[model samples]
Structure formats: C-alpha cells, structure tokens
Target chain A: MKQIVFQHHPGNVSSIVRGILNRLVIISFLFGSLASISFAQAENEVLSIKSPWIREAPPGIPTLAAYMEITNITESPISIIGVSSSIAKMTELHEVKLENEVMKMRKMADITLNSGQTLELKAGGSHVMLMGVQESFKQGAEIEIIFELKDLPAVKVMVPVKKDS
Target chain B: MNSILLKTLTIILGLIALGFGFWLAINQQRNTGPLISEEVGIVYPQAREIGDFQLVDFDGQPIDQQRFKDKWWLVYFGFTFCPDACPMALNDMKKIKVLFDEKIAQQVDFAFISVDPARDTPDRLKQYVQYFDPDFLAATGEMSDLQELATRVGVVFVVPENPENQNYVVDHSTFMLLWNPQVNLQAIFKAPHKPEDVVKGVKKIIAAF
Candidate 1:
C-alpha cells in the first residue's frame, strides 16, 4: 500500500523527498563504518609497548623469552589474558617465582595494568615464553606477537631478537 | 728442697705454655674476622664438602669434583629449557666475572649445572652456557647423581618424572653457590643476586680461607 501510494503520487516533491531520504541513509552507513574503524584503532592503542625484544637463544633451543614494558594509555585498566605468536608452536605468559629459594615457573592467568601503570616483563620475572620454537631466531631478526586482551581486540607487536647484554 | 723446687719449675712451665696457647688463639681470631660480614651473602664458618659425582661436561668429557679444584667457582643449577631464571642466572654469572679484577677473574670461574639431564645433553649445554660467556663450564649428569650433588650443596631440584613432553619446566634452586679452590661450598648468594654482592662475598670468603 505504501508503494502504491508513492507510485500514484502526483507531486514531484515526493520523489525529491525519497531521493533525499536515500542519500541520508547512505551517508549514515558510511559514517557508521568510519566510526567503527576508528574505534578499532583506539582499542589497539590501549596498551603501549616499549622496547619489546626477544632474547636470542642458542641454536636448536626449543624455548625463548620475550621481554617488554607495557603501559595502559587509556584511563581505564586493561588486562591481558594471553599471547600468541607464529614463531613458536606455543606461547604462554609465565612468571618466575622464588619460593624457598627455588625458581619455579608458573603460568599466569591474566596480567592487569591499571591506568598509567607500566608492567615490565623482564628476565627473572614475568615474560612471554615461546616454546617449541620451530627455528632459531638470530640476532636482529624480528618476530611478531599478538597479545590477547580481555574484552578488547588483540594488539600485535613486532619484537626484535637480541642477545642479552 | 731440690724436689720441691723442681716441681714448682714444672708447674711454672705448664702455666707459661697454657698462657701462650690462649694468646695464639686470640691472635688468630683477631686476624680472621668473619667469613662474610653483613649483607653480602651467607657464608658458613666451615666450608661444606661436596661428594663425588659422575657428570659430563659440555665437551662430552666426564667430569668429577676434580674439575672444580684449583679455582674459585660460582655454581648455578638449572636447565637449558628455562628461559627466564636460567638465562638470567647465567647472565648474572657473566656480570659477576666482569666485576672481579683481571687477576681475581683468572682465579675465578663459573659453572652451569643442569639438573634436567634428560633434556639438556652435553652438546646442548655447551651452546646454551657458552652463548652467555665462552668460559662458562656446563655439565649435566644422571638424575640420581644430580640429586646427590644437590643434597650435598644444600639445594634441591625437581625434574619432570616424564620429560617426554617437550615443554616440561624443571624447578631448581636459583642461588649461586661460591665454591673454594678445594671444591667446597664456602658461601651462597641467594636468588636475585647482585653481581657486586657475589664479588664482595667471594672476596671476603677467599681472604678468610
């Protein structure tokens, strides 16, 4: 019935009105997509990674450690649930705890970073453990890792492989 | 009267000997202060001796306690698969060596003993430790031998009962043990050791001995 009324309408005003309505719909769709793209970028920027590097281990070694300083740039706190990388068969967040003088490596559930707080994943501390490394990462090589954040999009970083000085 | 005088002379000589012995002990105590004073590290008044163990070095050569003789050693126990604690300890060992003078550095050496012998082979240990420092001595032995060595040194370690899983992590003591030239444990630098404390503690222990 609405289509019939529009087709039978006598005035040119209705056609112009329809044209304007169609243009408005298209414009709104475009703006919606653009807003989502910017939102995704903002999510990626929530955690800032500084001086990200992977410790270059000896050849044929099956395990490696990646260290970095991660700061929450947003006003809200962010939590990292896990990490992944193509450089190894498995990637996990691990921490070295000295219990009764014994060094025990424990898996972490989530790493929480409050607003404006920096969390250091360093040696003899928390680190991203890459196990079953397929190939030896030589010095100056770059490896890509993805940090999975809770309730947010994952952040990807390119970490350089360097010998511990 | 002659007998009485002879007895008195013997008693006087005995008293003089006792006084000399007491004086000598006091002088020794004053000369040797403490093995390690204050917050450096833990140093036992008497050095503990380590038992014999059959282990292989990075070069695939069999090594026993004799390998530790004639040089000061900063010994660390861990595995090659351990990324965080193990490598950091090895790096600290390197830094401790740098803190020593060239002459003292010559007399001092570092040892990386892997408790996870099932995974860390002799060849792999060589590359792992030498990657940090070329002069690092790496070794691993059977689990029983390693356990015995750990017991002697007052440290403990637990290897995976079934290490077939390639991702198994071994738990081991992280403290750096300072061994004298006689292969005896003289001091222990606890975990998160600073290179300066290790150097200072070693020097103090070496001087005392």
Candidate 2:
C-alpha cells in the first residue's frame, strides 16, 4: 500500500499546482483591465460642471431655465452645439442681451469655451432654455441635462431644481 | 465755396453739441437727490404722463390707468415666454419689495405688462406674475394698445408679424418704469437693476412727492 501511494502523489500534486497557477493568471489579467479602465475615466474627466441648478417654473409654463458654471480643464478649446434633457421636448441656447436698453432673446447655435476657461450660465444672461417642459419641476427635484459637444462625448449633468432667492 | 460752407456747418454743429452738453449737465444737477444717489438710473426733470390704454387684467377684469390709481407702480413689459430678462427683472422687483418696510410696501405695487398679447392670455399672465409674488399684477391687451402705452412710457416692443409663429421672441424694453400714485411716469430704472438702487430710487421719489 505504501508503494502504491508514493507512485500517484507526484501526478496529483502537479495537477493541483497547475490549477492554482491558471487562476492567478486570470485574476491578474482582470485586475489589469480594471486599472486601465479607471485610468481612461480619469483622462476623460476634463469637463467639469459646478453648482448645476434648474430654475423651477410654474405649472403650464412653456419654458424653464438652467444655470451652471462649466469649466474646461483641457488644453484644447471645445464647442458646445446644444443641450438636451428628457424633461423638455426641446432645448435651446438662449441669450438675453440688453442692447441699447432693449432686452432681446436670441437663439445661439453653439457656444465656444476656450481652453482653461469657464462659462457662467446665469439668469438674465446666456442660459439653457428648456422648451415645452413636459412636467413641473418643483423645488428640490433633481433633473438631468445632457450637453452635446461638437465632437466629444456628451456631458451629463444632474441639476437640482431651485426657486430663485 | 464748398470748403467755406463745410467749415461753417462744422462750427454750427460744434456749437449745437456744446449747447446740448450744457443742457444735459444742468438737467443732471436738477435731478440729483438722495433718491437718485447713484448714476445707475434716470430721473426725469418732470414726471411724464402716459396715454390711456385699455387692457384686461389677469383676472379678466378690464384694467386701464384707472385700475392702477393712487399707488406707486414699478411696471415692466415682458411676456410669459420670456425665459431670462422677465424673470430676472421680476426677481429684482421682488427683492426690492422685500427690502421695503410695510408702510412703503403698502404704497407700492408691481406690474408686469405683456407685449406679446397674442400668446399671453389672462390665465397665462396670472400664472406667470403670481409665480413671483401673489400680489403681483399682470395684464395683456391688443398690440395697438400695447404699442401706444409703451411709447407713452418711453419704451417699445416688437413681436413677430406672423401670429402663427409661436416660437418668435418679442423684443421689448428692459427698462422698468416708475409710476407715481397718479399713474404718471416718474423715473426710469435701467437694466441690470440692483435692488438697493431701486429701493433708494423709489424711496426718494415717494419722499419727494
């Protein structure tokens, strides 16, 4: 009996060692892929939005507005074609300019933000105009606005609805 | 001969400009007061009279100059579709209202008159103005009436020619007119209205009156 056990021990031990080595290789590969994915995400975080907020409007109102401070940390300039949100039927870049004592609302096709610059979307100035709002945006409700860049990935910003103070 | 005529014309134009500058300086001095502390707004030498306009209030009641009788009014012309300037100006007016004491608040009222009457119905105006403050008043009327009232108050607005173009914007004055209790135009508060300036202006005008 001792002679038989010694003869099979070498084969059994080698098989078990091979199985453990295979699992180690697979785990390292998985960790490598995850690290690269996180690195890519860190690289893509060049556009940052701060203090995003939506101005709550009354029920049955046709249009509402959103304001934010958008900063571009990249070395290249970016052009924002437009904005879209699920809460509105349509979205537009609207500018309220006081030209010669006349307040005029004009549709802006695109907004260009230079590299390392910030654009302030504020009330009584350039703002994101959501038209044909489908639902009422009460105070403290959260909404999502998607900004379409000219050639880059869309930036999604979650904004909270707030009443003007 | 042409050169001599040109020189004479230039001298006459220069004299006219100088005279105009002199008149403006004197007018500025006359209008200055504690109420008109900063040069951010315009205080007319004399309060101007506005022409009569027939309109319907947010409650569907007929409103004219008579409806706004015996109370100071800070009137702004904007439509409900206005996404920026109207809301901002109204917010400023709201802040100004909050800054005033009860006595002054009682003597003052806020009005938002819509130039885009084609879309700003009584119901819409009611929702729009009352959104800012329940006490806020709003009205809309025929384009002719709006135009006449705007001109009398030294403001103007132009809407789209086609009534079907619902997406069109109405280009209107950003100035807020200060009306005396008698319903006459008292002063003009320019755009980018600061609440402190507006409050000071209103107090001064009321105290002077």
Candidate 3:
C-alpha cells in the first residue's frame, strides 16, 4: 500500500494544491461581488450633503444662515426648487456678492446643481436664509432644514449650530 | 560627546528657559502686550479724515468725530436687519474686547453706524448693539449725514435699486476702521476680521501712538 501511494502521488498532490487555491480565489471573488453590490446601493443614492451647519449668532437673531456642501453623485443634474424649516416662518435661497467693499445679500428664486458637481453654501457666500426664526439657534443646537429638490422627495438634513470661531 | 558635555548642554537649556520665564513675568507686570498679527494696515498717511457729520447714538446723544475722540474707536457700518455680515463683524469686535485688559477695554470702543436710519431707530439700535455687547454704541441719523461721513471716511453704501420693495437691502462697506486718540482714521482692518489680528492691531496701534 505504501509503494502504490508513492507511485501515484506527484501529479495528484500538485492538482490538489491547485484545487485548494482555486477554492480560496472563488471565496474571495464572491466577497468582492457582495461588496460591489453594497457600493451600487450607495451609488443609487444621488444627492450627498455634508457638513450641514447652521451659522449661529447671539440670541433674538431673526435670520439664521444654514450652510452645507451639497454634491450630486448621479449622472443626472439636480436643482434646489424650495427650502423650508420648522424653526422659521420663511426660508429663502440667498447669495452674498462682495463688490466695491459692499457685501450684498441677494435672494434667488432657484438654485441649480450640475451632475457630478459640488455646491458649497458657505459663510460670506451662498446660504439658505431662514427668516423670522422662532427657535434660538445658539451654539450646539441642532436644526432640521428640508430641501425640496425638483423631481425628488424633500430630503431633511439636520444642521448643527456652529458658533463663529 | 560625553556625560560632562551633556550636563553642560542641559544646564544651558535650563538657563534659557529661566530667562524666557523672567522676560514673560516682566512683560506681564509692565502690561506691555505683544503685537501678534502681521497684517495691521498702516494706511493713514493720507488718512481719509472722516468729515464732520452728527448722528444720534443709541443713547439718543449726538455723536460726531469729536465724540469718538480721545479714545481708540473701531467703527463698522451696517444695519440691524443684516443677517450675516453685520452680526459677524460685531461679534468679531466683541472678541477683540476680550483680548485686552480692563483698562485698555475702557479705552477701546466699538461703534456700529447704521445706513438705514429709516429702520434702525435709537430703540432698535440699542437693542441690536447691546445684544452683542452692552458697551457697543449704535448710531443712525439722516441719510445725508451718513453719506457725508461715509464718503470722507472712504466708506460707500447704497440702498437696493427697487424703491417699491419693502424688504430692501443696504449694500455697505464691511471694513472695521481703527481710529487713534486723535480720531484720525489710522488704519483700515478689512474683513474678514479675526479677533487675534484685531487685538494685535489695536495693541500695536496703541503702543506706537
């Protein structure tokens, strides 16, 4: 039995090792496929908003500016048609134009976003203006702002009140 | 190179630290603050001296360049209705106050001049300024008075083109003008202003004067 085993061994042993390696490769490939599926789930979600913060000021401030970096991840473009917040009676899309030493805050009817583009609503620039705010937006407070996009469901974003440094 | 050499180096380092600590102690006792910001603009050789104009302060007292004299003044022009820029500037000034000692704080003054006299009444101005700091003074008067002071001070402001619009906007300069005790527009600290820079600028200005 030992002589027979030795005589039949070399090719079989090599093929067995090859088979184990192939099994391991197949297992890893299966996991890779699962990861790609999860990635696709994230890819399907188009609009990604980050660092949403409400610019806080002293108390009894009537208007609060909410800033965020908005990215449209999908192939299609997105535009912001309307904005609303429970804390304010009115919300408007506004942009600040600095020229001739004047910082001009102008209201916009609608703001558009291009595909694969990022919009930064930053301080001293564009912002979502919340006027007649009922709630105090002092530092460390969280406020919800609902952005109604064209042809999309209103996405609610929780913005933290970031005090001026 | 050897333990003896290492001991010498350590002792030298100890002496340097002791010297630094002594210098800091002397500085504290003398109340001589260091200038921190490098960007304090000294543009006052041809300083646009603010022309004569009288505006009613929040206390309903008349304020000309004469009133803000004999002390350092930091003036910014904006309205109470402003959302972002105005409040941010005022907050910056408040932080500038926190950078000084009590004696220097008394010497430094933050003034907000309103372009919209129609809206910012003494009562409204008082409420707006004291909301940031009780010591801050808010002033507004006739449009001509505001324009004359703004022009000579090299600050320009204009109302939004549409007169029919009730919710109008006033486009105003955001520079925080620093005035010496002589009330000459000594420096122009342009926005976006930082608390530390403003503090250092004020200290350097005071020290140099």
Candidate 4:
C-alpha cells in the first residue's frame, strides 16, 4: 500500500492568513461601533445646566440671586427666553449695567446663546433673579430650575446652593 | 569698502532701539503704578484723597463732611430692601470691624447710607443695620440730598420707576468708600470685597495717618 504524504501548498497558506486578517478587521469594527454608540448616549444624557451658583440674601428677605453658564451644543443658536421654578413665584433674567456711573440691574428680555457658544451669568453682572421664594434657600440644598429656550427643547438643571466662594 | 553707509545704518538702528526702550519704560510704569504701591505699604488708590459731602444719618442727625475728620469710617450705600449684595457687603464689613485692634476699633466707624430714601426711613435704616452689627450706623435723607452725597463719594444710586411697588427694586452702587477724620473721601473699595483686604487696607491707612 503506497500512502501519499500530505503536502502544504503556498496558496492554501496564503488563504488561511487572509481569513485571519479578515476576522481581526471585523472584530475591530464591531468594537469601534459599540464605543461610538455608548459615547453618543452619554452626550445625550448629560445635564443641560452649567456653572450654577447662588449668593446669600438677608434674613426675612425671600429674594436670591442665581448665576449659571448656559451652553448651546445644538446645530442652531438658541435663546434662553425665560426661567421658571416652583420654589420662586417669579423668575426673571436680570442684567447689571453701568449708566451715568450708576450700576443698574434691569430685567432682560432674553439671553441669546450661539451654537457651540456659552452665555455666562455671574454676580454683579448677568444673573437669574429669584423673587418671592416660597421657602428659604438653605446652603447645600439642591434647587431645580427649568429653562425655556427659544427653539430648542426646554432643559432642567439641578443646582446646589453654596455658602462659600 | 562702504564705511559711511555702514555707520549710517548703525545710527538708525540705535535710534530705533532708544525709542523702543522709552516706550517700554512708560508702559511698565503705567501698569505697575497701582500694584507696586499696594504691595510696598503705600496707600491704596481709593484712600489717596477725600471728597466733601453733607447728609443725615438714620437718626436724622447731621453728618456733614466734618464727621469723617479725626477718625476712619467705612461708608457704604444701600437700602433696607436690598436682597443680595448689600447684606453680603455689610457682613464683610462686620468681619473687618472685629479684626481691628481695640485701639483701632475705637477710631473706626461703619456707616451705611440708604440710597432708597422713600422706603428706607430712619427707623427702617436703624433696624436694618442693627441686624448686621449693632454698632454700625445707618443713614438716610431726601433722594436729591442722597444723590449729592453719593456723587461726591463717586457712588451712584438710581430708583426704578414705580420703585415703591412691592414687586420693583432699586439699583445702587456696590462700592464702600473710606473716609478720614476730616470727613474727606480718601479711598474706595470695589464690591465683592473681602474682609481681609479691607482690614489690611484700613490698617495701612491708619498707620499712614
């Protein structure tokens, strides 16, 4: 009985290498696709509020000042037309301006936010005026504020009141 | 081979260098003038001089320019209804008062002037300041009289239309003016001011005097 010895062909060896390479590419593609999907979900779930801070008011006074950074990441620019909170009976956009050497705080109609830009509301500058507060704003308390944007969806932010700088 | 041309070029370059040196010196001097003095025990810009004014305190007592003579006074303007910045400033001033030495404390006084005269009556002013520091004095007068005093001290106070309405608020300056015994406005401290800075500034002024 004559038994033929098995012979390895160069073409078959090249084919095996090609198949392994194709498997690696597919695995890498799958990983990359999943990573991008998770990243997108994180961005979508991010809270809309930015840099929310509060300053203390006097005793027996129900008014307080709240400041924050409002950023627009959407494709089109948006405006923060107003703010509302159940804690305060009235919430308004207030801006501090210097006229004739006097610092005047006035109610602003709206705060404009350009796409990919940020609008900062700070002390002695632009701020959110919280009037007729239903309760005292205790330090370390989380307050929820609802922002109504011009064209985009309304955003809600939980801001913690701080006592120190 | 061209000695004359080379000399001319060198001279032109030297002149340009000299001009640049002069510009640099002037710019540095302007920028550093305020900070250098403050760091080296020099008087602050706000406390360099004093202004003249006449007004009444919360008790309707006459507090003319003379009230500042021979003593140091921390004077700020606000109303009883002020919600945020005013109270913060007052509380900071109270801390400064406590930081002073007994001797300096005797020589120093804290005064709060009412920019909203219509509502900040003598009683209201008294009650408001007493809440912060019982030793602190509160003052108020006619709107025009308050404006006159405010102008002298480089302060501004404006009443919004229908400010009497419970929903409306008045806007006023956040600066605290320092006055000497001569009742002259010597220095001004900007708002969001810290108590430490104020204490240091007051000690320097007292030492200088």
User: DockQ for each of the predicted structures, in order?
Assistant: 0.53, 0.54, 0.32, 0.21
Residue A25 C-alpha lDDT in model 2? 63
Q: Which TM-score value belongs to model 1?
A: 0.79
- Indicate the docking level reached by candidate 3: acceptable
Candidate 2 per-residue lDDT over residues B98-189, each given as its tens digit: 99988899999999999987788899899888888899999988888888888899897889897444556789989888998788898999
Cα deviation at A13, candidate 4, in Å, is: 51
Best candidate according to TM-score: 2
lDDT of 3 at B149: 84
What digit string (tens of lDDT, one per residue) describes model 1 on residues B27-135? 9996677655455568877889886778889988888999999998999998899887788788889898889987788889999999987788888998888888899
Residue pairs with colliding backbones in model 2 are: none
Can you list the residue pairs that collide in candidate 3? none
Provide the global lDDT of candidate 4 against the true structure. Answer: 0.73
Off by over 4 Å in 3: A1-45, A57-60, A86-89, A134-137, B1-42, B101-103, B161-166
Across residues A1-165, which tens digit of lDDT does each residue of candidate 2 receive?
222122223568785666566666667777988999998888767688988888787667778888999999899998888789998877887877777889887788678889889988887788888887768779999988999887787888889999887
For model 2, the stretches where C-alpha displacement exceeds 4 angstroms are: A1-11, B1-34, B37-39, B163-165
Scored by CA lDDT, what does every candidate get? 0.85, 0.84, 0.79, 0.73
lDDT of 4 by residue, B30-88 (tens): 75555313322224444544455566777878776676677789988887665566777
Task: Quote fnat for model 3.
Answer: 0.55
Candidate 4 Cα deviation (angstroms), residue A61:
2.1
Q: What share of the true interface contacts does each candidate keep?
A: 0.83, 0.74, 0.55, 0.32
lDDT of 3 by residue, B53-141 (tens): 78999888887778887898899999876778888899888888888878778888989999998867888889889978898988998
Candidate 3 chain A weakest lDDT stretch, 10 residues: A1-10
